[model samples]
Target: MVRSILIFVITYALFLISGFLFQIDQSWYDALNKPAWTPAGGTIGMIWSILFACIAASITIIDRKAGGLNNLKPAFWIILIVNYLSNQLFSFFQFSQKNLGLATIDCAIVAISAIILTVFALNIRKIAGILLVPYVLWTSFATFLSFMFYSMNL
Candidate 1:
């Protein structure tokens, strides 16, 4: 039980660290042409917090179900880590570098990774897969938004 809690805490911490490291330049972002449907700044943060919590919970469940990370297949670890990193990279591309094209591509990869992770999680536990649905949906929407931003800004 303690180990599961540690996994959740660690995963959540990594997400928070990633966010802290790659922050948006609000002034620059405000200048960009965004869709009417784009979420407000506070809403984006709230959404991410909820999504990150879900991710942590999912990871904890998976770790517990699989009897720890060591027992799981290497592919599972690869998918999880890759998904996390790619998701973070979207922020780097969009906010840090202000490269909409690369951000769009990053979002597309994140969306795909979410789907892959969800499918893999389903094989392990149903709830684990279900938890990833929001992440997948959000990334898909972000991909579309990124593409729109790229098209309009270019």
Candidate 2:
């Protein structure tokens, strides 16, 4: 019980770190020309937080189902870590250098991670599958936004 809670908390913290890394909300991002439909920062944050919660729950459920970390879903775990690191890299690198090209790819990976997690969640746990829905949808939106950002900035 405690472990599960810890896992969720740690995972959420990792996501929070990714969000703030390299000062992603800095002036440069604000200065960039964005689509008229781009969401405000508060909305983006709220959406991301909800998505991250889903992801954390999914991870907890899936990991628990996989023989309590013994026969553990190695692939699922790896992909999740990759997804988190990619997200952090995107936020940090894209903001620091304003690298939209990489951000585009990074955002795609985020969506891909959500998809992978969703599929694995279906096999491992239903709660897990449901948990990733928000991430998949939201990250898909983020991917589209990233492409627009790249197109406009370039």
In order, the Cα lDDT scores of the candidates are 0.89, 0.82
Candidate 1 local lDDT, 59-135, one digit each (tens)? 89998899887898989889888888888888888888999999999889989989999998889999999998999
TM-scores, each model vs. reference: 0.96, 0.91
Candidate 2 is scored at a TM of 0.91
Model 1 residue pairs with clashes? none
How much lDDT does candidate 1 score? 0.89
Per-residue CA lDDT of model 2 for 25-144, tens digit only, reads 557788988999999989988988887788788777766887565566579779877788887777865787678999889889988987886887888888889888878888899899
**lDDT accuracy of residue 92 in candidate 1:** 88
Best by TM-score: 1
Q: Model 1 residue 91 lDDT? A: 86
Error of 2 at 46 (Å): 1.1
lDDT of 2 at 71: 69
| Stretches of model 2 off by over 4 angstroms after superposition | none
Which portions of model 1 show Cα errors greater than 4 Å?
Answer: none
